[model samples]
Target: MIEILDPAQLPRARAVGALVATILQTAKARCQVGTNLLDIDAWTRSMIEDAGAESCYVDYAPSFGRGPFGHYICTSVNDAVLHGLPHDYAVVDGDLVTLDLAVSLDGVVADSAVSFVVGQGRPEDTAMITATREALAAGIAAARPGARVGDLSHAIGTVLRAAGYPVNTEFGGHGVGSTMHQDPHVPNDGRPGRGFKLRPGLLLALEPWVMADTATLVTDADGWTLRSATGARTAHSEHTVAITRDGAEVLTLPPAA
Candidate 1:
């Protein structure tokens, strides 16, 4: 389902977006060497509860994933990329971790993700994370009224390809509003001007992720975490954006310190 927010709903959307962003930032800061993945999930839950916001993930049963995610946040470590279910695991130095989160505030929803090294950053891992971040930025810049969804996809794909990372089409960005995922699937790679046309009040979560070696993915025994087929490292970055008259407004930006 595609949802367009009315002017009155924008404020709620902004609030949810801010909350999601702040939670991700705080979780990232707390993730260090030896930190348990479950701890991260707990932190996310506390933050959401304290804000009186609802988690869009917990109890989320989608066809693509196993029923009831049963977690407050997605803690994707090392080779893991999407739908990473938090388990009994401790982060180590140089481990690339991706945290994806979505929450509802005042009946509006926003989703975002971020990837970074746990402790001492690896040069290659850092580069991969930077590429995804840049790709996300490009995608957001293309999200303007009258622009095609393909334009955003193309912009995101261009950055990943230029960075020498293969693009995966299976999972990508999507419409987000009252629900976490909605219609108008936004692929990471597509021809410009060839898909759904953007309109004012349209909210989209654009994410760009890539494996260091292969584009293929393998599911973990847990049935949720998706890891790279070759065990190569990976990175992911995402942001929630709202189309407007002049351009796109990034609702899930990190709060000013």
Candidate 2:
């Protein structure tokens, strides 16, 4: 279902977006070396509860994943990319971790993700993270009224390809409203001037993720975590954007310190 928030609801959307962004930033800061994945999940839960917000992922039962995600946040490390279920693992130095989070505040939902290295950052891993972040920015910049969804995808794709990374479309961005995932699927790559046209008040979660070597993905035994087929490092970056009259407003920015 595609949901377009009324102008009055936009404030609630912004509130929810801020909450998600704040939690993600806090979780990213706490992802130090030797940090357990479960700990991050727990911390996220506490933050969500303290804010009187609801987690979009806790009882999420999507077909692509195992029913009931049962986690407060998605902790994707190293080769793992999407739908990373938190497990009993400690991050080590040089490990690339991706934190994806979604939450609802005042009945509006916002989703975002960030990928970074733990202790000592590696050149290649850092490059991959930068590429995904750049791609995400490109997508957001393309999200304006009258622009087609393909325009956003193409803008995002151009950057990833220029960075020499393969774009995976199996799982990309989606419309976000009262629920987590909604209609108007946004791929990482597509032709411009095609697909759904953007409209004011529309909310879209634009995510761009890339694997180092292959576009193929393998599901871990846990039936949720997605890893690169070649076991190469990966990175993902995302933001929830609201379509506006003049341009797109990125709602998932972290609160100013």
Residues 1-257, candidate 2, lDDT per residue (tens digit)? 89998999999999999999999999998889899999999999999999999999889988887778899999999999998999999999999999999999988999999999999998999899999999999999889999999999999999999999988887899999999999899999999999999999999999999999999999998889999999999999999999989899999998888
What would the per-residue lDDT of candidate 1 be over residues 1-257, giving only the tens digit for each residue?
89988888988888899999999999988888999999999999999999999999898998777769999999999899998999989998888899999998888899999998877888999899999999998998888989999999999999999999999989999999888999899999889998999999999999999999888999887778999999999999999998989899999999999
lDDT of each: 0.92, 0.94
lDDT of 2 at 104: 91
Model 1: lDDT of residue 223: 74
TM-score of 1: 0.98
TM-score of each predicted structure versus truth: 0.98, 0.99
How does candidate 2 fare on TM-score? 0.99
Model 1 lDDT, full chain set: 0.92
Question: Which has the greatest lDDT?
Answer: 2
**Model 1 spans > 4 angstroms off:** none
